[model samples]
Target chain A: MENENLIEVNHLTKVFASRGVMSKGQIKAVDDVSFSMPQEKPTILTLAGESGSGKTTIARLILGFIKPTSGKILYQGRDIWKMTKDEWVRYRKEVQAVFQDPYGAFNPLHKVDRVLTIPIRKFKLANSEEEATDLISEALGVVGLKTDEVLGKYPHQLSGGQRQRIMLARAFLLKPKLIVADEPVSMIDASLRASILNVMLDLKSKFSISFLYITHDLSTARYVSDNIIVMYLGSIMEMGPVDKVLVKPLHPYVKLLIDSVPVPDPERRWKNRIELPRIEITSQSLQTRGCKFYPRCSQRMEKCSKERPDLANVEEDRWVACHLYQ
Target chain B: MPDTLLDVRNLIAYYMTPTAPVRAVDNVSFNVTEKEILGIAGESGCGKSTLAYSILRLLKPPGYIRGGEVLFKGSDLLKIEEEELRRIRWKHISYIPQSSMNALNPVMRIEEQIGDAIINHEKISKGELRKRIEDLLVSVGLSPSVAHMYPHELSGGMRQRVVIAMAMALDPELIIADEPTTALDVVVQRGILQLLRDIRSKLKASVIMITHDMAAQAQIVDRLAIMYAGKIVEIGDANDLFNDPLHPYSRALISAIPSISEKKKLKGVPGFPPDLRSPPPGCRFYPRCPHRIPGKCNVDEPRLIEVKNDRLVACHLYR
Candidate 1:
């Protein structure tokens, strides 16, 4: 049966035990998160938040780097964790990942060509050596990189933008249904970020590849993503279409986040200064019951402390987990 | 002009590699006025940090100032003796190095680290030092108890605050913060930038903020300088520069920034930044600039010239 959804994350939760000698408690890195990608439509969904917000944890969970402590992640109607060997291989090939640090992703010793060639050989993407070479050049060309310039060079020889593009090319070669890009353009220079982002946009429209674009930056998130998921302290603060969620944020946390993003225009400088919470929200101090963002939220209420708000649909196709909406 | 706090004239610093001298900061000249925030923005390897280090005479071996005059309070910093420079280092001028948040000593308590910076410069009583440390922590929006805790106990933003507190320990007239908020998150980064702005006003200090983040520069900088391949490509009032940039490199850079308020087609500057060791004879950004005049840009290097009131640009088009 052709599954309607490409990937479905059902009530996903990941708890990491805090190893600090002083505090031996569990950190709920991801808490009761659920979303899905459609198999037919290619869309860029961004998971954006500050550091320690569990955006990367969700990416890791989806990529199967670490097993979720609870909940099911169904890929094409199959449980990813309980997949057979064939299913696992198919899953790995169909789902690709591009990490933040381009330099760190590649083996320093290997030539850059190995990044493309090894994938082709392993996945049996080509019938023969000639076909593999053709495929390599095509993939590189798709990402706007010439084969000769990048093929024989070491990772360090190329600029950060080129290295990142090479990673994109590698992903393109696999013809992945989904690519979990975690901070892909954050390490690259500002001038080079647009090219990489444009390439992601092109891949979506041209090749019809869905992207789970994870980043802390809202500007870029708003640029490429069709949908946006705002996470804070291991829970979804808001999730909806990018235009609706970012423009008219229902949750106070999303509003604060959008406000914090420094607009490039000088005409619209920030008027009010934000007051950060003096007390740090450590895992040990997390109430385990209330809204996770209560400590920092500006519009937090008394009800926020007593009961946790579920990810409730507050608007048309917009979901906000906040007491204000309730 | 608003009482120039620091004036840099024809500053040139190069890293002497075995093969050749990498002209990291070449013919860079700018000034910081009283209580001004001057932002130096460029891609990595554009020598933004080196320019700051050169101003302080902090460059190590393989890196030396070729030619420059750093006039701080009417005195030539480059020609000053080590003894005179040491006295002026923290008292008159201070530096917050790039990623200095992680530079804190994990074992030492925050107070001890802050105290070390103070006693090294001047003598103060233990009681006075303790009180000063508490005051510094509170000023940066941290609690007094933070002084007693180790670096590991504080979050990234809080540690950054502690570093800022240490920089302001002596109440210097100028503070050079290199990528002060690069490692931080958006909300945390806003708070830190605000703290820097507050510190500037409270202490009446001029700041030279070096970062590639143009948005962060827009938020805090009073004047902005765009650097390309070891040279100042554009400099103007932050508002004017953002409103209408002159240099093609500056225009490309400004346009490249993704904005949530406006959705427009973004284009990265084509090609890579030229290697500083063997830069092109003409315009360094010629290869990447969209408005490159083939024969002219490849032959004649453009000099930084005043295009308008307080606006400087280095480009053949402007000339």
Candidate 2:
């Protein structure tokens, strides 16, 4: 049978040995996380979490930038790590990534046009110079960037929004099946975020390209993604359809994450103040056998510290990892 | 008014470059009432931070105050001597610079950092200072044991609380926090914003919060000022500004923010902000404004005029 999934992550885990002077234990950066993106339908899957939650580690693992400690990342039924050299090139082409800082992605010495041109030449997408020029203009036009305005400019010469759009244009040139966007708009201005997000929506509908959108901003994630996975301390806290999970969060961690987002409306200010626990930055804190969020969870139980709850399906189209559900 | 704590009048701060003076804070005017959180909201490089630096007289080389009067408690901070200004800095007006969580000395313990701020202004005994440091840390929602740890030992949220503790070490009547919650996580950001609210209510100290996050401004600020191209385009009550913004730019800015509560199509302001060195002849926002008049908005610059009850806007449409 043909695999209907575009990518499948099976029990992904990554451990980083502490090299700092203050801490001296292994840190489970990503702990047995698993998810899949469908190949038939294009969907935007958002990996939502705070820093140190291992959302970026999963993104890097899928991109083949790092090796997982004990897990497998299967792209179209083939194990990525076990793939041949030809398969690796095809995997790299099919999976593209757009990082947070657009300025850092480009070399300052080269013109911005080189970013789009190099991708097409490397992927062998075009034959003649004329075809390459046409491909470059087409990609830029898709992302709403004009050729004359951005072609000859250096990275600093273009505004932040323009440079980010150029990055999107470069990603579009590959015609990839999946794009992993890590905090694409967090570095740009608030007023310009909507336009970039709109371009993402356009690409999804017009080009049928899926996105692995990783962000801590739930507001933008809600605006775009069809599904979301809430991670905390390298473990999956909640996973479901975006509206179902965000509207009525199941896990305590997901609920706290949603509540903490400041609403733009002034009439509905936060009613209650939450006092955070004193976060300890030691390796000992990371070695908890039970729930990692037990220290800060408001709905902690006696059993929570003794046993860790697995991500179990508690409702239709929703999975939550909490002792309350289990 | 008698309650006006900070009165900034036509403040013009520029960066002196080789080509021309970059008008960072251009002809800006506003008033911060006592015991109210005044928010200055704008995108990056719109000169909100420069305005804060100008108020504190903290501008460095290449940054000159061409003309302005920062009248705090009926005295112009601009005309004050350096020695006199130093005296008023921590004891009367304190500042939490942008990314101040990283501003702490890495080697020093948390208590010593708080102690340094206290000892600089007042001569206190070591025993008394230690007691004060613990109290400050507890007030910002940190444990007393955090005082013994270095800056690196603390998380980003804890370090931010430590910075808040230091700012409150002197109990200044006014605190200006520039993007205090910018780099923090959402949960930590909410905690920091709540701490700021607690500071305003418990201490009755006025706050001037400068940030680009409109949602954070809505959560904390009582009065809001929307900045664009180094000018105050609109200033009004936070409720009124969110409900019904007067200026087009303010409306665009308020609408630009994406919210989970409402499912609305997000619209970004089209064009980039004009260069400060040579801004447009008429309005700086005329290029991207959807309601720009053909010949009028591009010809005459509009001054900030009171449009409604306590609502001021600088737009030809308002006129």
Give every collision pair in model 1.
none
CA deviation > 4 Å runs, candidate 2: A279-281
What are the models' TM-scores? 0.98, 0.98
Q: Let me know the TM-score candidate 2 reaches against the reference structure.
A: 0.98
- Candidate 1, B1-319: lDDT as tens digits: 5999999999999999989899999999998999999999999999998999999999997999999899998999999999999999988899999999999999999999999999998899999999999999888888898888999888999899999999999999999999999979888898998998997879989898999999999988999999999999999999999999999988889989999976789998778988788999899998877788999999999999999999999999986
- Model 2 docking category: high
Where does model 1 exceed 4 Å of error?
none
Residues B199-296 of candidate 2: C-alpha lDDT, one tens digit per residue: 88888899999999999999989999999999999999999999999899999988888888667898999989988999998888999999999799
Local distance difference test scores for all models: 0.92, 0.92
Candidate 1 lDDT tens digits, A1-326: 67658999999999998788776778888989999988989999999998888999999999999999999999999999999999999999989999999999889999999999999989989999999999989999999999888999999899999999999999999999999999999999999999999999999999999999999999999899999999998889999999999899889889988899988876777899887656566666776778888877778888899899999998878899988887
Candidate 1 lDDT for residue A58: 96
